[model samples]
Target chain A: MIDTAVLKQKLGDLDEDGVQALLDEFAAGTPSAEETQQVVEACQQGMEIVGENFEAGTYFVGDLMYAAQILTAALEQLKPLMSAGGGQAAKGTVVLGTVAGDIHDIGKNIFKALLEAAGFSVIDIGIDQAPSAFVETAKTNGAEIVALSGVLTLSIASMKETIEALAAAGLRDKVKVMIGGNAVSAETCEFIGADYWSKNAAAAVKQGLTYVS
Target chain B: MSEEKLKIREDLLAGRVPKRVFMQLRFTLEAACGLAGVDLVKAHFDPKTKLQAYRKVCETFYSDSFPIENVRWPEVYAPLGAKNWVMSSTGAMQHPEIESMLIEDYDEYIEDAFGTIMKKILPRIYPKLDPALPGAPLSFAKAYQRQQATGGEEVGAQIALSEEFDYAPGFFVGLFCEAPFDFLSDQLRGFRNITLDVRRIPEKVEAAVNASLPLMQRQAIPRNPIPGFTVFIPLHLAPYLRPADFERFYRPTFDKLIREINKAGMAAFLFAEEDWTRYADALAALPENQVIQFENGDVQKIKEVVGGKQIIGGFFDPLITLTRSKEACIDEVKRLLDIGMPGGKFFFAFNRHVLDIASIDVSKLVAVLDYVHEHAVY
Candidate 1:
């Protein structure tokens, strides 16, 4: 039996030693389904704490990435156990990439980790993607959402072009589009015909989840 | 020097408003020429035609811009070629692939500088920058070759144009030296890697930044101080870190760099990007009279935090300048002037460069300057 409160606190503090102690105990074999769920829940709660710290300015983007890595490491350790216990399938498919002419992907990569932890299958089309690629990926994967990421104002044109391409491909109504990055805003989303835009990776994951269930 | 240009420096140093508001419109020659209907690629080789085109664009579009003694005319008129003229070793013409990871292992980078940077890092990341294998280090030779290959023609053309220019010509000062963390995040390690490394191996990150300090100082420090000039330091990776992280990983080196730059009688023109509202207090503690150009932070909060010490230059939004009506533009400028221009140490600039000339209503820009000159007087 693991004390989840202690686990949550340690994970939130990013105390690798303390968090690893709990994860090690669970991964040592013979943990109940309840225990595995609790461990996953603790990681989720830890991410919420990170998001709070980020909003309060105590944690930066790099810190959030660190927290995401910890969750990823913990998940990697527990993946077999979760699978053996018949865990939930991926809730939805997400098509993600950095739009054309804008090559920044740090934010997009972080979002990918968080969304994957939340049990979404992400198809990253890589950076500097053409608008048609997003449309084609969504059509093939039957993706629930499309995420276009860029870190330049110049890419706003690309985002607009991507949405137009989706509509031209006659696949606009089937999938939701969320555009995000350091350079994107709600106004930019509207101008580019994206369904939404998020301020940070946490919100992006949350928003991506909403489109699924 | 012209009386107007002299007044900009005097007012800034003395902590008084200049006779008229000073405006720094951030535009590169390519974008400027593009706006003015000149093909920069063709014009690059055509030196005589290029100078005439530059003058025509300047007279037509940028005549109202505040003329500083250290005018960046060389930068404006300089031909596009191999970017290596500033830092030959870095190999300017080649673009680093955004998709690939430059440094796969942090330990390799930590264990050896020249060995990893030259043999492993540069060769893999930018083959053009890595001139030779480990046994024969030939960066200086490469620099010479690169200069002869690309620099002579453009340098001569730009110098000739500068010598005859009416205003004080600003020369290329030097390349930027990032605080250790920024150098890692920017060139060697990606942002994701550095962010993880800060927690996983704190000592290695600190060692890397400390080791790179002298190298950055070598690149950044000017040999001779140009009068009334400012070295533009684009502040990246700082806003991404928390207050404590910035203090530990960034601030000390940045403060040292600022102190050294000031010792040489020049100022650091920091393009303060992103939302640095959290670190405003920490930033306020830097030396006074340095220009802080805000891009996204709340101008009022920044004004309250660091306005008295630094020469605050912004709050004018480029989107407003470009997309909004002329009346909307004037209102925004007047609003910023009212908030920022009370006790001097304020200049006019946009958060980002107005890339599309059609987006800017030059008359509206003139109106803002005119309005500030008339009403926002100290």
Candidate 2:
């Protein structure tokens, strides 16, 4: 039997291989549910460490990438079991994508992970997606929240156009629209008639969840 | 030393640059380059061309001479497009059968899977195999030679020629530190996921960061010489991060990275791209002699935070030179100078890289510099 305390400490330490091994051990039916929750708590602690490092300027993009990798690994083990018991349905469904003419996916991907963890079912439309694609996907998925991300300053217009098209399609009011990315702000959100302007992925999910609820 | 070079360097050391010259130079460069002419690639071959052009434009407008420095000139190199894929380069995850073996818990397989796909497609889409390309083995040798020729003696010959020049110093050949969360949010995690991750699964986010620090630190070497000061680029952080959230998620990482870097005998330069006025005090509390360069941050607030202990750069908005009239450009520069120059330790320049635009007037920049140099106090 694996020690839940040890596993929790290892997860808090952000020990990828250790956590993975414990997860594997758990998959083999070694650890109890109580142990699994400990591992989850430890993982959360690890994120706080990451946040600290980031604020202090000790961490960078690559570190965040690796952290995400480790977290996803542990989550892989926990997500299914957590969902099985109707633990948390995503607060809402967000159909998110980087608008057309922009290939930057790092921001969009981060937002997706944050949103999913926040209990929102995120349908990522991928990068360089056309405006029509967003509207069509929102309609098809019946997604209550539509999130548009554009890093390129030039693509801000495309986001607006997408919003306009949604209105033209008579579906604008039906879905809550959120706009985010480096160039986006409260002013841009207002100018483009978006319901919310999220400065980061976390803020986006929070706002999306509220709107949906 | 030429007064121009000395003045600029002094300002940098003191944490501020005279405003008139800074504004004038910016306006002149903007006018001369136009939007399309600031070719980042060409600037690599001869950085002096851009510098000289700016100087010439300034001379034309204000009729002043700015001496060129013998300091190591800046260059640009190709990015190792595949370095990010080095871990997944083996295509181990791409095989559908192997991918299928991935248990539901290993969701990172999706990233591995996608990386495999992109690596396969890269060759077909951009099929140019130039040995001279950055990240190629030969490129390192070439960079070494260039460094040697330009009076760089310390480990200059060791630089890989193909390395891309992302910043002035480029990638340190030795040990370096980075904020882990920034790494994930800016370089790896698509923005959407990072934001969601921080709020929803803060634990997973923290764990991922911890696992990578040792790996990053392993890359750090003691012999690495950081010139000027350490620059913490908050480009991705500002638009996405809240002041309170920054205090929680980012401050600790920043503190650790700075402590380690400082212990290794280097200074920190916190470069905030967005309006960092809200978090200035938190940033100021880090270490002394640290430089804070703000892209769009308020100058007065930045000054108040650092309080003359550290250097501060950037108050002139790039948009002024890019879109506003030349007269407006001068006024803006003068405004920044009036406020920023009183305190020393200021290095002046546009908030960001000088973009090429056609309508910008170069002479205004020269005139501004001349006016500032003539009027600036010690």
Candidate 3:
């Protein structure tokens, strides 16, 4: 019904109008659930290219953010079409939050948008979230990956607490943990007991894809 | 003050090597409050108390001048119901990028950007600021006046201190200003909105950025240069842009704002607040006399790229100071001085902010500064 490869290229190209027009055109024909899933996977692949471009320094923080926005809106336009044929199944669930005592969210939001673009169903618990909140959400949602974000150095302490809570809840072994933000370092990551730490959102998304795949 | 201590500024401006490497540094509100053991909340409310604490902090550290203690009256914004510059967990006032206070559509803001700030956006950010809301016109005027009086009395005291205190290098007062990119995202569209708006409505975003610069500049830089004062701009959002986008959207206004300050014979000090390795050439492109404080970057690279045209500083890391052993911390200082000092234009300071006294080993911090004062000489 639509050239999924072309749509993916438009997404990687960050051609928002082109991506939207193509998605709208594809949806008008009422694609099948299986076919729509292919389109969605292609979009995710396009976002992978977007992430790659970001990693290559061709794109920037704004470009990654803008690409995610396009992916999000494009997904919404395709959602009903896939839902009518049968619901679009997310690759996996990822629980994300900025740990307690920090209110900064730009980094967290960027990570969330990119995670969503990579086709994971992300539950963003928002800023200043407690460890208990993370445990409860991960348990309830059966999240496979828990991503913690913060900007303040104080937030590393909270990230530690959140991970410990996950361990205490017996959910630690079940989920892969990623800690990120200005405050996070490999030293802090190892100390905090996170499985991985991302310096940028694109690398973080790449990690998310690795965990799910 | 001795001619030698103050001579550093003139030497730096004239592009000459001075007798000794100068020292200039800043601590965030939280760090200052925690270091002094002063009540953070009280410091936020009472300028006199904050200044006293600040003075003690400067003196205790044997600082050549006070840290940039430009609260510029944050409590004044509180009554206006400020969203960004509100109190934090430690009671220290900070402008965290929480929710951007501007919730209105871009078209209206795009149409007249500065006017939207005055008529619409400010009201949304500061809910208590309606002059026509009946009983009290902006209700905080009386309170603001009282606070100003208290602050004014302290500023008057600093003059007397300069005469008596040898450590006082006099105030290098700065009028705090925001770049249009910073204000547009921080105050209005925020990170997400502005991020998308660049792609979604490039024309509107450009219009808003272009229109807001003049208003931001007029309100920030002094027409006649104050003797020790400079225009301080903390570059926030520009680092996140790819150089092309930054040049298109931010470079012109940022360069112009600093150039005007320099043209008026006042040095404009800018805090290149994040990882700006990509923009080092762009940063070096600003007028050489104007000062630039880097929060993070290669000291050698900044010097090599800038070619000692400007006074270079701010590569000493607080993370190393607070967390590393005393020897390690001092080694980093020696490393910075080795790279930075040979030119005679280096300023000794921490690269990143030490947000509080929580992680600090005072002896280590003291040792680092003491070492700088001792070894970092021409």
Error of 3 at A25 (Å): 0.6
| lDDT tens digits, residue span B1-378, model 3 | 767777875676566887777777666656667777788778766666676666666665655555545453565665677776765554545566544434345667667666767776666666676656663364568547756875675566555445445443422463767777776777677777777776667777777787778877786766665654667777888877867778877777777777766676666667777777778887778787566778777777887876467666786766554457899988888888888877665677666566666535677888888888887777
DockQ of 2: 0.05
Expressed as tens digits, the lDDT of each residue in B1-378 for candidate 2 is: 235543554355444644333221223223333332454334334545554444443334432222111222232122222222211111110100011111222234233434423344233222222343554555545545665554452233212211211112211122334565565454444354565566556665565555444433433324564544443434346334655557666767666766666676666555566677767776678776665566676787777666466666675554344345567777777787676766666555556433233222445555555555566555
Tens-digit per-residue lDDT, B1-378, candidate 1: 345655664676556777655655555444445555776555544655555555554454432232211222223222221221121111111122231224345566666655666666654453444445452235435545544644555455445544444332321233455655666666677677777777777887877777666656666776766555666677778888866778898888878877777777777778777877777886788778888778888888898888888888865765544345678777888788878877788877767654334435556666665665566555
Candidate 2's error at B307, in angstroms? 4.5
Q: Write the per-residue lDDT of candidate 1 for residues A65-137, one digit (tens) a residue.
A: 8888898888888777777676667889999998876656677888888787777899999877898899999
Q: Pick by lDDT: which candidate is best?
A: 3
Task: Please give the lDDT score for candidate 1.
Answer: 0.67
Q: Point out the higher-scoring one by lDDT: 1 or 2.
A: 1
Error of 2 at B235 (Å): 9.4
Better of 1 and 2 by DockQ: 1
Measured by DockQ, the strongest candidate is 3
Q: Which whole-number lDDT from 0 to 100 does residue B372 have in model 2?
A: 59
User: In candidate 3, which residue ranges exceed 4 Å CA deviation?
Assistant: A85-92, A139-142, A161-175, A191-193, B1-4, B36-39, B46-62, B68-74, B96-114, B146-150, B153-172
State residue B291's C-alpha deviation in candidate 1, in Å: 1.9
